[model samples]
Target: MSLRRILKSWVERYFSDEEALILLLVLIAGFAAVIWFGRMLAPFFTALVIAFLLQGVVSALTRRGIPHLLSVIVVFLGFVGVLLALAFILLPLIWDQLIGLVQETPRMFASGQNWLDELQSRYPNLITPDQMQNWIGVASREISQLGQRALTLSLASLGNLLSLIIYLVLVPILVFFMLKDREALVGFTLSLLPQKRALMARIWREMDDQIANYIRGKFIEIIIVGTVSFITFSFFKLPYTALLAVLVGFSVLVPYIGAAVVTLPVAAVAGFQFGLSESFVYVLVAYGVIQALDGNVLAPVLFSETNNIHPVSVIVAVLFFGGIWGFWGVFFAIPLATLLKALVHAWPRGMKGRDERHHALASEESMEESL
Candidate 1:
């Protein structure tokens, strides 16, 4: 047979249905293995996230005429110093409030029962006090069990604390090397690709820009949310304002629904502490205002370009990852979504051919322009 006929026959043989099915299974298994491995390497994943976030700061310092080593040192020292200061300032307050809350748990339970009694008195058709008490008892038992489990987990990792310290020590060292050699790393990676595909270097740079913008925007948003929450809590004369505000603020890092998770518990406690009506209204209004500001003003201004994800995609990713990986999944949902979007845009259009590829490239270029 001629060479052309032999080439055509080889292609046809390789593209057979059985081969395709085998390939599909292989791909699926490979993907599953990757996910499992990623889960197993969770601590390294966390460290990588921390490094990615601090990269921009270190780069900025380096660009401003600081030596790379000194820049890394400065960034690391500043970070640790800030954390230490915050610990000194905030931990005592939080510790005291937590201790007080533990001591007052019985009183809080009584207050809850009183509130239930008031509700029953106002609406005689409601459930009986005995039923309510039973429900509360069940809830209390569950909460106590959860608390015990949490304490066990915390104490169980006492030996791992040394490893955590080593990780903390090594992170800045890794960051320093990464920041110093980032350009070289990029050049090396690009060199591995064929010359015809060098244009992809630009695409990678763009993706990096997108990720950096997102990280910086998120930092700003967290600060804004925390400050606003603290101010609002102080305005309402709420108990444990510092602790609650800090919780709410830090929870903002998780994207979409996390702020509410933090707020709801604080509000519930506030309701039990103050009158139900007063605390309910205060927390409701405060959180509502903060969310509105976040959605309308702060988000639009800072995250307008960074969050190119659709609401449906966000919800799907959150649910899928949350189910698979729990808290870490939820924390990483947005960044993961962003990375997925980048990959989708970068993927080759095979079935649709060059026209579709061109169109996709054009659309991506337009999106970059808009950004």
Candidate 2:
């Protein structure tokens, strides 16, 4: 076939209906809005996510014979309670531990430096003086940089306090109304779209349940992993237990990468406190067991309903979306990846279905003419 004919055939196969074209435009517009207005509407987005998380609880409560408004109210109050605990209780502990960790950095570095010195002396042939100097220089520079960044963060946080206040005031209101008026809000949103939305409906049906299950499962995993990590660290008498536990908990957000990255701090804290002793070994072994169980058992059970996405695809999605939207990107990486897969699967099915209908119509016309 000629290039023009090939192009025409491909377009006909892919974009045979206005639904396909409209969906493409909607996706492009949605992405552009996020890229442009995401930061400005962060509070809205955050509230939206919080509402999504709580909606499941509200639904469950309603299913259990509670009134819808009562369920929403109960769930909202619980959300507020959790937020208060984080803000007033858990946060303060984490913050204190973080500050303590920063203050203890110099002492940790000194111990590390002493260990390196002893290693150099014992392995003089293997550890050249130049290499030793280079290593020390690198460590010194890194510690210095960490201190500088911490200082900068402290200063920036003051400016962010106002922003935080806005979120505090606005987010709850938005979340409450969102829950209370969810059906109306959804109806309004749907009204904005074309009446003929069979393809869109198909994609939404798949994504809505999939994304909800993924988010709920993920939060549960984070809580379970983080709580377990905290208990384990406390058992080992590890310093900065709260801080390290928070890291370990949030690390579940990035799948393989999160666990690996958090391990450094856990091991460093263990090694610093107990050196090459059995305590350090035990802590490390315990951490390994936690990770193994999480990956092999907890994750599978929680995410059984989610699509069987490839590991490489998951990693790539994390990197891609994380680069695009940072924390939220990383947070929603898997769901976003699932959405992409849904779109890919949905669009082809839509086109083929439309093609079949068109052929059927043509055949009917031929039969009528023959009659």
Candidate 3:
């Protein structure tokens, strides 16, 4: 076939289906809105997510014979109660732990420097003075950068306080109405959609189930891991148990890397405190068990269906989305990746089998090779 014929074939394969065109247009429009006006619509988007998460609870209660409006009120109150507890109970509890860690920082730095000096003294050939100096310089610069960022955020907080207040005020109101008027809202949205939304509905169903499981499973995982870690560390009389537990909890946000990074501090604290004794071994073993169980057992149970995306794909998605949207992007990277995969799998292709398309391309390649 000529080049023009190949181009026509490709266009027909991609764009001949009406449903595919509509889906493509909708995806483009949605992405455009988020990319162009993300900051402006962030609060509304945030409200939508919270309401979507809480919908499960409202639905569960409704199924148990409770009225929809009553369920909404009950769930909303529970949500507010969580916020209050975080503000009042959780903050004060962690504040003391933070202060203790801050106070120990200088001591830890001095000890680290002394240790480096000792290493240089003992292994002059392996660890030269110049190498040690360079390492220390790098460490110092990194610490300075971290401190500068914190200071910048502190200054930014004051200017952003009104925005924060607006979010707090507006999000809850939006969430409430969203939950209370859920049916009407959904009806309105569906009415706006195209009459033939079979493809859209299918995508919605798949996304709904997976996203719900992923989000809820994550929330539960964090709580369970954190609570277990806190109890285990406390039982072992580890210093800074609260702070370490919090780190371990949030570490689940990043699958493999977070746990590994956190293990350094835990082992360091244990080694400094216990000096390679039985208790130190015990703590590490316990931590290892928790991680093993989470990876092998808890995660599998929580997410019954495999996402079928590779770890490399996951990491790339995280990097790509996180670069665009920052923290929230990182958090939702897996779901977004899964959504992309679903879209690719479901995209119309002029009724051609994917394998057939691949075979045709391979045949062309073989013909070119022979020629």
Candidate 4:
């Protein structure tokens, strides 16, 4: 086929449908907004996400014979209560843990240097005096700079504190109004769009369910994993248990990579605190069990009916989105990947098949293989 013919064929095959065009434009606009005003509008976006998550609870309450306003109020209050608890109790505990961890750093380095020295003595050929001295020098410099960096970060955090306060105040207000006026908000948003939104509506319906399930499941996973980790670490008398638990909980946001990367800190803390004692082994085993159960059992149950994108697609989404949007990007990687998968599968082609759904499935499978 001629190049022009191939181009025409591809466009017709994938983009001839008006719905596909609309979807493409919407995605482009959404991405642009995120890239452009992501930091400036962080609170609004955060509020939107909280509203989305809480919508399910509000809906459930309404279904259980509660009035919508009452439901919104109840859910909003519950959310505020959690926020208050985090601010007053959890935040202070984590802050102390962070300070303790920082204070322990010098000792940790000393212990590490001792180990390196022992290794160098045992393997003279492998690690010479010059190399050992160089390593120690680098470590000392890092330790020295650590205090300076912490002070700088402390100053920087004051600015971040203002932003955080804005978020804490604004997010709840936005969420409350969003929940209370859900229909008005939806109607207003839909009113701004063109009258014909068949394709957009279909995509929204699919995305709404998937996104809701995914978000709720993730929140549950984080809470379960974090709480369990905190309990386990506390029981084992591990230092920085709260901080490490929070890290482990959030690590689930990145699937396989998260668990592995977070294991380093947990093991390091355990080793530093307890050396090779039985408590260290027990801590590691318990941590391993939490990860295993989360992956093997919890995730499967939670996401069984949600998007089923390949692991490769997931990792790519994490790298791509996380590169662009940083932490939140990595956090929402899977859902975003699933959204793309949905768009691809649902993109209308001019050609007709005996079974259209089956054809879409086949096309999606082909696309996945290419990816």
Task: Provide the TM-score for each candidate, comma-separated.
Answer: 0.75, 0.93, 0.86, 0.90
Candidate 1: regions farther than 4 A off: 1-34, 37-43, 62-70, 86-96, 128-134, 185-203, 277-280, 351-371
Q: Write the per-residue lDDT of candidate 3 for residues 1-371, one digit (tens) a residue.
A: 89999999997888777777888899999889888898898889888878878999999999999999999999999998897787678867787877676557656556667778988998999999999999889877866786687678768977777886788789889999999998899999899889977678878888988987788888888898999999999999999898889888887777786789899888877766675589989999999988888878887788777486788998888789989987778778889999999988877678564455557668989999999
lDDT of candidate 4 at residue 281, scale 0 to 100: 92
Q: What would the per-residue lDDT of candidate 1 be over residues 1-371, giving only the tens digit for each residue?
A: 89999887655544333323343464477458747886566555665666677788998988999898888778777867765676577777887776666656667767877888888888877777788879889869966886787578669767666766666666555655566676787789667555554224544565677776777777778788888888988887877777777787777666567766876667666787577676678777878788777878887798777747887898888887777778767766777787677645644433343345567679989999999
lDDT per residue (tens digit) for residues 260-322 in model 4: 999988988998888767988998999999999999999999989897788888889999989
Is 2 or 4 the stronger prediction by TM-score? 2
Which is the winner by TM-score between candidate 2 and candidate 3?
A: 2
Candidate 4 colliding pairs: none
RMSD per candidate (Å) reads 7.0, 4.2, 8.0, 5.9
Candidate 2's displacement at residue 71, Å, is 0.9
Q: What are the lDDT figures for the candidates, one per model? A: 0.70, 0.91, 0.84, 0.87
Better candidate by lDDT, 3 or 4: 4
TM-score of predicted structure 1: 0.75
If the candidates were sorted by their lDDT against the true structure, best first, what order would they fall in?
2, 4, 3, 1
lDDT of 3: 0.84
> How big is the positional error of residue 53 in model 4, measured in Å on the Cα after superposition?
1.8
